[model samples]
Target chain A: MIAELVLAMLFGLLLLGIHRKVIARIQRRPGPPVWQEILHAAKFSFKTTWVPATASGALFAGIVLVAVGIWTAAFFVMMTGGSLLIIFGIYMLHKIVEHAFGLSSGSPYGKFGGVRSVISAASEIPLFVSVAVIGLFTGSLELTEITAWEAVHGPLFFTAFPAVVAMYLVLLSKMPFGPFSIVESKELVSGYKTEHFGAWRAGLEVCNGLKTTVLLATFLLVFAGQLPVLWMVIGMILLTVSLSFACAVTPMLSPFDSVTIQSLVTALMLVYAGIVFTGVLP
Target chain B: MGSLGGIPLYVLEFGDELVYFSPYTITLFLLALTFTLLAIVSRPERQVDVAFGGDAYTTKIISVDEMRFRRFMAIACGLASMGAMVTGDVFNFTLFTAMVGITNVGIVAAVKSPHVQDAAYQYGLVALSATVPLFGAAALYAAATGSLSMIELAKGTLPAVPLVAKALLVIGVVGEGMAPFYAAKAEMFRAPGAPYVIMCSLSSLLIFLRVAEVVMIG
Candidate 1:
């Protein structure tokens, strides 16, 4: 599990680097190297991390630790074929971590970011629906069972494509450059991380990477099933390119617009779920 | 397990009339209890100060009477939530849910802001109205099974209760500010106190969780 987590972080950071490179190329600018995130983390680690005088000391100091811990647990659960219910629980807890990250800083920007996190709670339902859809087709909520089913019946992506779309949207909302990235947009002065600098910010960056890796890995696991190492890396790259393309083409939506889009996706998924539930869409 | 005063420490039974504690209830009970403790301990001192027509930076301290009342309400909310989770009787669950609603109002009632007070008033009305459906669901179950005990209901011996009754139970709990109803309580969070105010969210969440389990088991 520890090894998987460490590899997840490495791949996560690399994916982010790939995303930046792709976006920069599309925008006609020279971007940082694919290894830029590693360098960035190394630099931040050398700086002295300090809590701001105006911040809520305990909550402020605890956010990064909590974020890292939650994502690590998520990775562990996924790697071990543990309960998907537990993974869903971890995902919900991560929302609270975002709220805490913003609220703890006592900065207006952080507070707004925190409120945005709360507003974005609507996105959670679609993810839950996606889980239900997967459970329905696989006849189990355990990753082991789902993977075993896939081993016999093949990837669910062909049959459950709508759910795949919904889950992808959930992943998009969490990733940088996505429509929901407004929470940390430059206009908000980096939003929740406005106050957390140096090592703390680095911790958050690492957490972000881990979250990305977990989410993408989950998508692959459920939709594509288990693949050989070379094939998995190829799949990850293809996914990264597709997400980057979407990010490049789409403008950032207002929080209201983003929620509306998520709601529509959720509605579509629920309709699909109803069909499946009614035995009309075998 | 070990014994505490001649009663088993791990499981508690009271002839099935009062409450029963098993591994499931104990797990969720401890979860709610721990969050309540954390809510009390993690009280943030920065209070939101509202200004009517002038400077907003002027500092003001919460009055002792108001603080005492808010603390009392918060503790009451916590205890009521604990009761809702730990009780074996469906009627008692509904009763404690109603208390949770009342105390939710009490927790924010001390704030001297019109907007917040207005929201609290609205939430109170909605929450109070929820009791009809809540108690009605329990009553329907009792009528169907001749017993309101969840242990009995979970035995699967009685006729399956109507779906509407289950729907009523969920809707009543949702009135405690889950999802669509959350808009009514959103402004109440703007009240100055963080620790006491968090209890409002915590209690609602716990009740909703317990409702899910109860709905499933029963």
Candidate 2:
């Protein structure tokens, strides 16, 4: 568990650096220095914290802590011998708490951010379903069980290719690229994190990095299973690159359409059902 | 695509087998066809002008390129739907369904005029209505079967009474569909494009609830 936690944190920090650099390159501008995110976080951690007059200071801080706490917990859950359901539950709780923290801020931007958070949370379903489907195929949601299944069966994606594709889409929703990135765009001015600064700002950045790292890690665990440690590291690096590229290339799709959501739900459901009927889902 | 995140169970089991389309794929294809046909055939001669009402709002119309992007997304949806059908894995199928649903919502939002908030609202309602009962049925099924494997359920023949129950389940599904429409209409009065964001976010919950039902009931 300790090893996993350490590995997860280290990997997360590395990805943060990679994400910054890659995004910069994509934008065709001199991006922040590779270590800029780390330096910024360090600076903020040392700065004095601020609280708005109308805000619930303690609650605000508490929510941030909870967000980080849950993120950390999710990492451990993934590492430990827990079921997939437990890991997912932890993830959902973390997101909910993060949103609650956003709501604690009194600013209108903060309120809007909170609302966006709710919207983003709602968008998590298809991805969750994808994960659940993978669990079902293995006859166990336990990581170990899944890994063992992978080793013996040689990858569910090969047999259950549709699930693999679905998983990829779910991954997209979780990170929310393209049209799904409605929660954190500049229009909302960082959405929930708008009012945070100094150490709070730093904390959020670190948490965001951690969140991304955790997500990547979860994806790896689900898709790659027990690879050699060297392979794992290399694979993670590649994933970071891919994500950076994804962020760079994909047009940011607006989340302001009801039809977009409906379409996603309907399309995914119909396809899933069709797979079952055609004997592809087992 | 790499195994660093740990291999998914399906990957471990199947290992690069060619995925095939199934009934779910057909449904998505049909839906996509219907939508495309609607877009092509029902190109309204006069686009509705955005009339600012209630609170003052700023709205930006999506560009033609964005419309193309929606079509690209639709293609992705169709492909995902086909893939899910081929896999015969319930979890994958459900996930792809949700993605396609969300993508469709995005496409509709992009094409429709801001004045047509009612259309958006109706879309949301349909999503909610469709999802609720689908999930409810899944949950009931999971509980009755003592397993969450959708494949198992798919293979097992259902009793006639249960089939009726499942048919009646459409009511809740329809309610799921109606939810976004109402939500879209409500948001139009506040933020002009609020429905899009709300629907995107809701997609996650809707899919989650449905899967939870399947896991619990199936």
Candidate 3:
């Protein structure tokens, strides 16, 4: 279990690093190596660390543990093939964690980032509906059962294409420079993360890595069914590259527009779910 | 999902009130407990408000009275969410969910800022209206199924839970604190107390997850 977590952290950071490299190439800029984020976590860990006097010291510090702890739990949930509801719940809770990160420090920029994270809550709603769609199709909500169902009935991507698209959009929202990622847009100066530094920031990085890994692997497992470890890694990279391409080509939406587009996608998905639930499309 | 590990076992029960903690609820319960514990022991952060286009900034300190009240509300919100996470009856879930809504509004209602107060008032109105559908769904479940027990409902032996009731449950939850109505919620988060304000969001998310599992299984 420990090895799996460590591997997830490292590989997730590598995927994030490659994501930057891909976007840079698309934009005709040289990007840092794929190890940059790993190095970033290390460098931040070694830097001098102190809690800001203006900050709520305990929450400002403790929120980082909550952030990492929830994601670690999410990692374990996926590892055990428990339930998609738990995984998505933890992901949505991260929004609150982001808000806490910003508010705990009491920084205006961080506050704006945190507020944007709250607005971005629409992004995660689609994942719940995706879970609903998958459950409707597969007759089960556990990953183990879902994969087994897929093995017997072919991939859910074919049967539940709208859900696949919704899940893909959910993935895109979390990509660093995506049009939907207004929370981390350049104006906020690292957004919710601006207040965290040193070890705290390192912990956040670790959480992000684990989150990216869990989400990517989940999409792969749910939509494509089970695969060998090597194939799973390859699939995750391909998925990350596609998300990177989307992030690189489009400019970040204004916060209002970002929320608007996500809400619209959610509406579309809801309509699709309604149709499926009512036997209109089945 | 409907059921973790595709099994059901009530961990504890007393009379009509009981608790069931699937692997799913266990995580949520732990998370709520963790946040509540933080609220109990931590001091509120002094918020830093910056003057745009300049380096000047000032820290806003929370007063003792405000801290005490908001801490109580936050802990109440956390405990309510924990109840929503593990309760065995549909009505109990709704009751816990409604309690969470009330406490969420209370969490920021003490702030001196008119902005947060105004947001809290509006959110309170929405939350008040939400309980209409929330209690209605719970009542509808008992009427249609002849029992409020989730274990009975999940057995698939009771008259199939009405799709309208399920939809109503989701609607009630979304009304409590989902993103579409998050304009007010975002404003509420603008209040200075970090540990307390976050409980509002965490509780809603937990309740939503639990209800998702509830509706799916029923």
Candidate 4:
């Protein structure tokens, strides 16, 4: 567990630099150098911290720490257990904690962002149910179990093809590409992070990096489990490249009106359920 | 237990020691190259245009109110998708996908017309009509096949009952995809090309769900 945590944090740092570089390349500008992310982290540590007059200082600090700490811890746990259900629950807790911190800041933007986070949380239900269904079919909730089943069963794709498609769609939403990026739009002037600066900002950045790494690792452990270790590493690298490409090509979606998001989610659920029942997936 | 179809649940036998080979590594590298080439060469042009150039058509700046709505939906879609994908459950996967797709289409349609209210009503009706039949078909398929294993049906080696069931499943998948496209068109042509918002949300949901499903189910 200790080894996994260390590895995850290290990988998170590495990916942060990679993410910055990729974003820069995508925007048609020379971004800050690769080592810039590390430098920023170091700079943040030395910077003076501030407390809002209206906020509970110790509580505020604790919230941020708890949010980041819990997420990081969850990542390690996920690596060790390789259980899909447990991992999902931990990540959800992480998200909720982050939102709490945002709300604690007492800023209008933060409050609104927190509300949006709740909405996002609500939308996750169907996808959550879908994955549970997968567990039901495979007769196991452990990541390792699913992988072994796939190896023995010759890929669930042949049987649960629609479920596969649905899974892909869910991935797109979770990583929040394009339209799903409503939570982190620049126009909202940074949304939940509007009031945060200096070290707090830096912490969030690091956490974001960690979040990215965790999601990537989870994706690998879930989908490409049969790949040899080296190939899994390669796949992670490939995923980074793809994410960069997606960030470059896709426009940010607005989150002002959730009706569309809700409708799409509903439609997807019904369709996916229909497919599973019909037995047409192969 | 007696062997079913002459296959054992566990087999533990090795003739050779496990070792990493540099040549095998090179083969993977080569395979990656081929995969990239294929992805680039066979890329669909329509998707590229929609993804990269859709913003150019917009004439008005998005209002703050609109931005808020977009943010709400994006986060909602993103979280929902993430949750479903990670659950690694079949039911959650299907339910989330359909929900995300329908909601996206409805929103797009509602925003696209001079009469937002009318558009929403119409879209809602359409979604209802489209989805109900699909569900019925799927249920029928499930009943006829008498086999609950998705893996077997996907193999295309299922008995007669399952074959018909599988055909219905395909229709349902295609229908879900259509809801978003229709919504996108409504947002683009009727509204102010706000389909990108719906599309992005759907894309995020789709990607997370796909990777998770593949790992868990595949």
Instruction: Tell me, by TM-score, which candidate is best.
Output: 3
Candidate 2: share of reference interface contacts reproduced: 0.00
The full ranking of all candidates by lDDT, starting with the best, is 3, 1, 2, 4
Clashing pairs in 1: none
lDDT, residue B56, candidate 1 = 68
The segments of candidate 4 whose C-alpha lies over 4 angstroms from its true place after superposition are A156-178, A256-259, A277-282, B1-218
RMSD of each: 5.7, 14.9, 1.8, 16.1
lDDT of 2 at B162: 50
Off by over 4 Å in 3: A280-282, B1-10, B52-55, B178-181
Please state the error at residue A131 of candidate 4 in Å: 0.9
The docking category that best describes candidate 2 is incorrect
Question: What lDDT does model 1 reach?
Answer: 0.70
Ranking by TM-score: 3, 1, 2, 4
Per-residue alpha-carbon lDDT of candidate 3 for residues A126-219, written as tens digits (9 for 90 to 100): 5568788888788788989999999999999899999999889888988888888878778889898897999999999999899999999999
Better of 3 and 4 by TM-score: 3
Comparing 3 with 4 on DockQ, the higher-scoring candidate is 3
Question: Model 1: residues >4 Å from true position, as ranges?
Answer: A39-42, A280-282, B1-37, B45-104, B135-162, B179-186, B195-218
- Give the higher-DockQ candidate: 1 or 4: 1
* Candidate 2 per-residue lDDT over residues B8-68, each given as its tens digit: 2342134323233322223223333332332332211111123456554332444557545
lDDT per residue, candidate 3, B183-206, as tens digits?
Answer: 745668778888888787778777
